[model samples]
Target: MLLKTFGWSFAVTAIGLVAAVFYGGWTGFGVVAILSILEISLSFDNAVVNAGILKKMNAFWQKIFLTVGVLIAVFGMRLVFPVVIVAISAQLNPIDAVDLALTDKDQYQQYVTDAHPAIAAFGGMFLLMIFLDFIFEDRDIKWLAWLERPLAKLGKVDMLSVCIALIVLLISSMTFAAHAHQHGGTHVDKAETVLLAGIAGLITYLAVGGLSSYFEDKLEEEEEREHEAEEQAKRSGKQQSAVLLAGKAAFFMFLYLEVLDASFSFDGVIGAFAITNDIVLMALGLGIGAMYVRSLTVYLVRQGTLDDYVYLEHGAHYAIGALAVILLVTIQYEINEVITGLVGVVLIAASFWSSVRRNKRLAEAEGSTEGSGKAEVSSGV
Candidate 1:
């Protein structure tokens, strides 16, 4: 099962290692290895959240996710996306940006880092909404009942998630702006940019998610009509909705997944700069890590891991909430990547164990009930 599932990931890892060696000798290989591990550690929650969405999709989309999606994840976001950010933010031509990356890596890193406020504003708000919506929405299963239950109750307030997110962005921007003004800090100009970027992020989230829902509804309507016309006599009011145009749906989903990925990678890409400003090595390393993350997403979907571990999604969203808040804070200050990565990993790991314990308890109770029923039967004999 492992081999069949992760064969592609293993093959890609081997190629990445070989390429690293060829590109920069053994030192390059070591850098990519560390980069890959760093990406995986930082993105484990990403896999869980992704699986939740991917499973709702059909088989064709899932295959595309594993195949073409990996390419976009590696080259597009991990490589070209950062370059584009540099090119745009630095007001340099693409060629100049490329040159900066190749000839003067530090300059390239600075441009990308300089764009952090916009990145943080957009990504932080989008991610914050994701966390807030997840926590605030009603669910039968919850991981941190103490925290989540209250949020769930509060979810009844219309637009509560968006309101909370805006309030956070407002306070963060005002506070940071004030501090920057008082201290003559350079990043003070970020106040206005943060709000604008955050709104853009929120809009993007709404548009993509809304489009997906609209198409899904259309697909469902089409399915229901087909059932009524053809199978009405055979089966009653039963329908399994399928994508009307597999190709088109796959295309949109591909785009949606890429956007979602880019949001998640914002922090990772920035954090990589903290380690090293070598864009080439950063791309190669983070790219390899992204491939593994895609593989893990597929694994979770195929194995039905989300269904097995009910609280896994809750934990992943909670981690996202932490990261979102951290991103906003990072707009004002530097935070150690280790702390950020650890917070996410720890939340997910703790949730995994909680799930395991719950499963064991349920199994024991079930076994005892079965034993009691059998005893009654034997006594009658």
Candidate 2:
């Protein structure tokens, strides 16, 4: 099962490593490997979250995610995104941007760094909305019942999530972005840029996420109707076709996933320069990590891992909330990538452990109940 799931990922890794060696020798190979590991470590929560959404999609959509989505993730975000940012920021043409990235990596890195505030603001707000919406929704399974219950209750208030997100954006803009400074440079008030970018992010999330949810709900309604029809047919000894997400619903969901991925990649793209400024190396390395993440998402869906580990989604969202806060904080202050990755891993691990304990306790209770019933039956006999 493991080989079947991860065979393509392994192939990509081998190919990327070989190419990296040819491009920059063993040093390049080492950097690519480290970057791959780094991307995987940082985005593990992302995979969990992706699985939760992807499970609802039909097999065809899932295939599209693997093939087309991989291209967007690899070349579009990991490679072209930085170059595009540099071109716009540095007032250079696309050709010049590519040349600059290949020839003058320091300048390329600088242009990318200069754009970080806007990037952070945009990605942070988008991810913040995701975390907010997740926590606000009342679910049958709550990982942290003490907090989630109260939050879910508050969710009853119309647009409470939006209100809270806006408040955070306002505070972050006023406090952090107001006096943010570049390295060895004086304070530069980026409050306006942060505010605009954050609003754009928030709007994008609302538009894309809202549309996706609307269509998905429609799909669910249609599926429920089909389910009723199927039941009726079953009673009559007739066959009914299966339901699937299609048309506008699948398209918007695909768009939502792509945007969500872009938000997740914002930090990683910026942080990749800390390891290496070679665009090709970053793309190859992060692309391999991305393939593994996609594979993990598929495995989780097929294996029903989320169904067994009910609290896993909760943990991923909490990690996302923490990452949103970290992104906002990083607008003003430098944060170690190690701390970023560690926070997510720790949260997920703790949640997984809690889930195990919950399962064990439930099993023990069931055993006791069964034993008591048997004793009572024997007594009666």
Best-performing candidate as measured by lDDT: 2
What is each predicted model's overall lDDT from 0 to 1?
0.72, 0.76
Please tell me which predicted candidate would have the highest TM-score against the true structure: 1
Give Cα distance to truth, residue 336, candidate 2, Å. Answer: 2.0
| TM-score, cand. 1 | 0.78
State the lDDT at 201 in candidate 2: 76
Off by over 4 Å in 2: 13-65, 81-95, 221-285
Question: Candidate 1 lDDT (Cα, whole model)?
Answer: 0.72
Assess the local accuracy of residue 23 in candidate 1 as a C-alpha lDDT between 0 and 100. Answer: 76
User: What would the per-residue lDDT of candidate 1 be over residues 1-381, giving only the tens digit for each residue?
Assistant: 788777877887898889889977987777677667767756766787678768767787787777877777788778986666557555779788889888876677676567666666777777788778888998888787888788789999999988888898898778753333212335556678778877877886677667656655655655456555446545656543434444455555556666666656754564454444466777887887887788788888888765676666666677777878877777777776556656766877788799899999999999999999999999999
Quality of model 2 by C-alpha lDDT: 0.76
Candidate 2, 282-359: lDDT as tens digits: 888788888888888888888877566667667767866787888788778877655665676677778778888899
